[model samples]
Target: MNFARTKEEQDRLEQIGELAVRFSERAGKIDEAGDFPYENMEDLKKAGYTTWTLDKEFGGKGISLYEFLLYQEKIAEGDGSTALAIGWHMGTMMDLSTRRPWNQNVWKEVVEKVKKGALINTAATEPQTGSPTRGGLPQTTAVFENGQWVINGRKTHTTLSPVLDFILVKAYIPQRKKVGIFLIPKETKGVSVEETWNTISMRGTGSHDLLLKDVRIDEKYFVETVDPVNNQSAGWLLHIPACYLGIAGAARNYALRFSTEYSPNSIEGTISDLPNIRHLIGQMELELLQARTFMYAIAEKWDRSESKVELQAALGAVKHVAVNASIRVVDAAMRIAGSKSLFFENPLQRYYRDIRAGLHNPPMDDAVIAMLAQKALDGIQN
Candidate 1:
């Protein structure tokens, strides 16, 4: 709700909002057919929105976390699946702008590729180990052979698998006893997607399994070796909550529209004038208002933060509140629409399923709670 802080920001958001409206037109079809939003992504690419987070020098808008979340939230209002699918590439690129874990020239080249509409996302989750954020060592292996690195492993949750120009694969280097990030081109030999993503939710994401069967690339593809778990918090991850918040916003819009128009002979005027419907509408707004405040406050802090460690607790807490609050908002929206919301043709049902996908995203609720508890205990001890 009016997220832009300046005139320029408002203009940018309005432009993206237009794109979101276009994407929303097909969201229902995509979700019902469980098809990838390739056309939606093409729209983003043609509009040059895909490179918004890259630095100005890299031919990008170089927006901050606050601005990125604003744009992402707007996009999700159109299509949550599309928002989530692109969020990985957008957030990863934003995070890399600061982390700079790869060789300087190599990273610059990759950014150039991104500027040219090439897409990228990290393929880290695995069937056996779960999300990489959980500190699970990747079963994927990288071996040096014939003067090149050969990678072998299957990655689950490889979002944008259908059209990712390049995949940043997390693989354990047995010889080095460390994990390395390998850049494997989608067209690389022995690389393939299994098309196994059949989840009932976020179906448009095309998050299939990325299978690498001895896919070999030169040494230059070895971007960097990193610890299995990164202690540093990432501000770009605010995109997750931002997307869910947008979904909630969409639900709120639908419920409000329904309440005002869907009047029965049993009631005077419309349901919007009814006290119980009014109560649900007010509660939904209240929930969204609280969640939005928390998300944006932390986002601004993250943008201005000088230390990652200091923002760790806030990072998790924002995601926790935003995701759970978005769920409540959608539930209330469904209630207002009554059984019609459950109809296969209703967009509300799609919103309902897509919003729940946030719960399984990174920074799970249990981990956030544990971290907050530890922070409280440490504060008391000190």
Candidate 2:
């Protein structure tokens, strides 16, 4: 669908690509250490990259959804965790600023923080509630007392919590009997980040547990989005699939290089000449192209269309195809590498592990399939 529709967008992509190359150089060390890529983030901030998604009126790039996805995929090529981690902040910021769901003045202040390289994310998930996407009430509670909302709960899977200057905490308000997203500053009293992230994949994300014990915040920070339930046309979530596609691309390239350069002593030519190796490479190319087309076309469509209707099934299906295709792409690459792909030192091993993380993201496969099935049934009935 050739979505890069403007020269300004094309130039922005080039600028971000340079930063991605620098991030690529440090991705391995950050992954090996299982720590946040502080230096990589510093470089990104210094380059004025944190303002990409904010509206142009706010002195930011105001990039469209299509441009954002393209850039995110490129960053994922350098480091999937960085791309995925920052996706929450970038996507959430863009969504909030564009829609203006809550307090406008509060958001303006948040934008200033974003421009200054202050990170942010919606801390919704908890150990007991699982993903908010599944539609369970949050365990975190918000109470009004003494001119402030007292927040008391622990949130898990809070990505980039360690570096976040602001957090949109989803908490249950008993008095209102509705969910509210409280904007809590990081330096607020009783707000602390717990070191609980210990996953084998996407280790640099720092998706640790966030503790908000009696954390107090001004009531103006609470925002209630329209149609909270069934509000499913989230273009920003495309970043997740874009990330997997990038990881798959990385694996595919590594396999192609290995096949081209490695020639066994017993064989006169490299594996690139072999029919089986060529077949796997071709398969990966086809899958990647197909998945990318689906992802990018939908993102571009979201930019042009004004419909607020929830394309729940369509949204989930895109993630399903892209992520599953990505796994296959990585598998094909691993098959080509054989035993060498399993070694801890090989980049292929890292890609393999990281790509799997996509499966665990929102829009779980089973729920997606059920939604698609119901859509078909509803269509038939109509």
- Best-fitting candidate, scored by lDDT: 1
Candidate 2 TM-score, true structure as reference? 0.96
The reply for model 1, stretches above 4 Å from the true place, is none
Error of 1 at 339 (Å): 0.5
**Given candidate 2, what's the lDDT at residue 33?**
88
**lDDT per residue as tens, model 2, 1-382:** 2346688877877787888888888888888889998877787789777788889998888888888888888788888999899889889988887888877798888888888889899898888889888888888999989888999999999999879999999888888888888999999999999999888899999999999998988878776732235546687888899899888988988898999998999887999898999999999989998999888878877888788355556778889999999999999999999999999888889999999999899989998899889989999999
**Model 2 stretches with alpha carbons more than 4 Å out:** 1-6, 225-231
Instruction: Quantify all predictions' global Cα lDDT against the true fold.
Output: 0.92, 0.86
Model 2 has an lDDT value of 0.86
Backbone clashes counted, model 2:
0
For residue 301, give model 1's deviation from the true position in Å. Answer: 0.7
RMSD (Cα, Å) of model 2: 1.6
User: What's the distance in Å from true for residue 204, model 1?
Assistant: 0.3
Cα lDDT, model 1, residue 43: 93
Measured with C-alpha atoms, the lDDT of residue 22 in candidate 1 is: 93
